[model samples]
Target: MLNSINTNPGALLALQNLNATNTELSTTQGRINTGKKIANAKDNGAIWSMAKMQSASSQSLNAVKDSLQRGQSTIDVALAAGDTVTDLLMKMKEKALAASDTSLNTASLKALKSDFESLRDQIQKAADNATFNGISLANGKTAKLVFLANADGGSFTVNAQTLGLAGLGLSLTATFSTASDAKTMIAKITDALQTATNKLSSLGTSSVGLDTHLTFVGKLQDSLDAGVGNLVDADLAKESAKLQSLQTKQQLGVQALSIANQSPQTILSLFKG
Candidate 1:
């Protein structure tokens, strides 16, 4: 059915083509402006799901990193206290040796006993005060730290390891009842020093091992963060190029739309002729 004056198929077809071009141009412009191929939930459901997963993983990794850092700090505090205790023990041993001398008078031996008592008090104080984040590491507390993989949901346990102070066999109590008893007491203090020294050496080894574990976990966290960034981070160069192209296409689409609207005027001129 042929119908209508001032109606031209050429003009109609051109207008339709122009409209389609305009829609395409607008879509590209939106992508350019947002710098995202899929800016909304409806754009790419699969990619959105993957991005969410990456975000969740990144959060978990960060939490694990914090846990490991606190664990390291706690271990450092314990190690430092251990070192202080060993030094005090060494000093006490020296005082014990001095007391062993027979030339020393009763007064001198009594003073040496007092010095030994003071050193023992200092060791106990160091142990009692060695804490991190309100958790004691050297006070014979049951604290342990643990690290886990992402597959395990990044699970971690704190306050699990406790140093056994009593097991180290260090006696700090004054035992000399007389000047003659000073020799035996000094020998006992020496034995305790040796035992404490061995315990401190073991603790040093454990501290080194914990530090190594922390280093490994830190590296793993870095790698996980990089992976998360790769999943969602924008490519600025590509976005910039796309913006330029979309702008040009938009301009061309506007011109094409203008030309299509003018095509109907040709039919009006034919009717006047």
Candidate 2:
């Protein structure tokens, strides 16, 4: 109520009100521009810290997913090689059976023997070539493929199944020249076929497991992202409305301050009378 030329109480009061409104307007504008209610530690320290931790976890899962995918691809290569070996064994068994027939001529037996030898060699080649990323699971090159499963330092291992000729009990030196030799080979081929088939099935199962875990990791990362968003993301609609209201208040505050600053002129008028 004091109207003094030296100090205007009304102007000081209006300036304080205007500064408060400006602060609120600045905050609202920040939320709208950044689209985050807690953009930094100053905005909301506790919530921002929590969101950062969750975001780190989500980012770490990206590495885990990559590891799992690499493991899956390695297993898939092994499975493909095992399947080829199995097929070759089956074909070799057919050739040996044909050679086992006593009625077959010497030339016919020799032809069948040649075909069997070629098919038998392919099994070794297939196993040796089952490689991915410089690692092989079928030729005794690698014992297992281990991959990260989670952000908590957990892992999964896919044990290797060696499918080499020696590993499968198949002899590369075995001959199929006579009926008795051919019968002997048939037995060995049967056992090798069974072993290769089982190995392939195991690898297939491992591939499926890797794929499932990878999908789960992806979903978990998405959930973490959503959690972070819930903690810090701004509601644009609400912020927009608040921005408009604060802008109006700021305009009104300026006008009020201007009127208060003119109060010294009123004191002069009183003296003029």
lDDT of each: 0.66, 0.90
| TM-score for each of the candidates | 0.80, 0.96
Per-residue lDDT for 178 in model 2?
97
Q: Which lDDT tens digits does candidate 2 get at residues 5-79?
A: 899888899999999999999998999899999999998899999999999999999999989988988888888
RMSD for each of the candidates: 3.6, 1.3
Residue 134, model 1: Cα distance from true site in angstroms:
2.4
lDDT of each residue in 1-273, candidate 1, tens digit only:
333456755557657766776676666666667666666667678876787776576667666666667766777887788777778767876887777788888898889888878887887788778788887667776555564534345544544323333534554465453556666766766676676666566556656665665677667767766775565455768767765776676577667667766765655676684
User: Residue 127: error of model 1 in Å?
Assistant: 0.8
Residue 118, model 2: lDDT of 92
Clashes of each: 6, 0
